[model samples]
Target: MDYLLTEEQKMLKEMVAKFAKEEIAPVAREFEEKGIFPQEIVKKLGNLGLMGVAYPPEYNGAGMDNISYMIAIEEISRYCASTGVIVSAHSSLAVDPIYRFGTEEQKKKYLPALCSGERIGCFALTEPSSGSDAGSARTTAKLIGDKWVINGTKHFITNGEEAEVCVIFAHTDPSQKTKGISAFIVEKGTEGFRVGKHEKKLGINCTSTTELILEDCAIPKENILGDLNKGFKIAMVTLDGGRLGIASQALGIARAAIEDSIKFSKEREQFDQPICQFQAIQWMLANMNTEYEASWLLTYRGSLLKDKGLPYSKEAAMAKLKASETASFCADRAIQIHGGYGYTKEFDAERYLRDAKITEIYEGTNEIMRIVISAAMLK
Candidate 1:
């Protein structure tokens, strides 16, 4: 029932906030304008151990709790969502499943490098036709002698082009439908694996999202992530954690927009007085603040459930659903408050609005989140 953060958590938050303001905020606009990946900044984040905050120390992670992980994501995202997504995709979708399901050998081989950021990792669950319907993956993996040959195309894979490894899902038995899915570790530069094309996204441009083509790519049977035909379970379980990270990202965007809007309102003038004196502007700010707080509460609750090792699927979905919509709403208002400047690249509001829209679309769309939440309630 304790609402206050522990001393350690508070310190972690301060460290992340300091890093974001000093290191990330300044270059966010430049990266967005130039469409650069900011590899150097990503390496700096890796050095700070922010890349794997929630992972165990043995794997070169900070070994912090889920709340601390969420805090780090929020702070980084507040200044730069691209970096936030890079970290989130690495931690939640890529590393978490390995930590939770990989065999000891698999952990020994992959976890350290991934956790240390020596190599980036990506998760490939969404295919050209399968996004929310993860169970409907058409990617196929067939055992051929001592190796599994995989053939499929994955779309909208975050960190796809730059990652050294990918945790991929494929259908081992199409007849079994959802139960046929299996997870595999596919390294880059494999014989038949190739990066297709990078997507020119609407926002979070610094993080690479690309298409991956697996044309008879072969990997040893030992590369299977978990038991055969059990990937559907792993993918769904991994998404619960991923959704929390996305929720934190949404919270960060909203926080930045609200703070900036308030500051701008007090300084912006109309009729020889600050906009803060106007009722309409004040009401907009008030509503944004209220919604932002509510989103944080939801996100924090989901993180708490994760730390306690409790079932968090419903909470995670709820947090993602509310926080992402709240972020989009707040960003829109921030842009509105900025008047014409908000529509231009000179102000961060335009970027914030663009970035906020993606939060509602990825990590399972808000509509999908509602389905998850409602399904849990019905049960």
Candidate 2:
């Protein structure tokens, strides 16, 4: 797969991998245990021009390709899943929509700060009543005078607690359902908008998966993203890129599990010899590596399609589906190989398992991925 990457991309990968190993790995466990966001690391990433790898330099980004972005996420997630998502949710979920659909004014006003990590951003679509069925969201918005008044409670929003900017989805006409949904850019300190309950998750604990409450929150009419009554398309398109980001994260997790298991098998003694000598352990390691390579290739294919500006919704779904499941599979096998130590807090195998589960659930569940893939095929 290294042959698939351009020289610049390969260099980017090596640089990010080094940064993650040196900066993120030392603090990953402590940060997750305490639920502390890696603000400094994010700032460093921004300064290194990694926060917006795929965007152009005019927006203060690295002006790299999509593969570079995926490589960065994978390297970062290899050390810390929580930090991986913070970057993903900010770049793919939040910045991408603005860059793709925003007005020129919006781009100039937001992209620089966001790409520079001066301000964090989040995408708010999921709600208490709405998860996979985004069309059924109950949030509502109405135009008044010079403002659009929005009212909604969006939960499970990554980077919610720290996000200074949010992309919100709401219904302009509930009678029309999905067709009536619209996107809005709501800045922090907007009237009547506040961060809500913080969730205690099983993994990715350092991330702020919290609720965003909007009670008659009002923003300028120009704050509307894309077009009125066309937000569903925007959401769907944005998610295609986001799924790839998650897939890359999953690939990192799987790699972590595989690498750790390989290391442990050789050192751990079983009946007077290293456990790596056993066929069972060897088979597990072999399967783990094979699945990881498959997932990586899938994810890279999707990234390549995106860089070429092709329709990649189906490819993204497939990559996400396979990579997420592989992450869980590899993590479980890593735990089994580590025996009792893997189950305990002393080792990271259990943490890997916990982190891998969410990849299957978020950025559209595996069930949703199946629907997307099958729908594409049937069509």
Best by lDDT: 2
Q: What is the TM-score of each candidate against the true structure?
A: 0.98, 0.99
Candidate 1 lDDT over 208-289, as tens digits, reads: 8999999999998899999999999999999999999999999999988999898889988999999889999999999999
Candidate 2, residues 1-379: lDDT per residue as tens digits? 7998899999999999999999999999889989899999999999998778899999998999898999999999998999999999999999999999999999999999999888999999999999999999999999999999999899999999999999999999899878999999999999999999999999999999999999999899999999999999999999999999999999999999999999999999979999999999999999999999999999999999999999999999999999999999999999999999999988899989999999999989999999999999999
lDDT of residue 185 for candidate 1? 94
lDDT, residue 20, candidate 1: 92
In TM-score terms, which candidate is top? Answer: 2
What are the Cα lDDT values of the candidates? 0.91, 0.95
RMSD to the native, candidate 2? 0.6
- Clash pairs detected, candidate 2: none
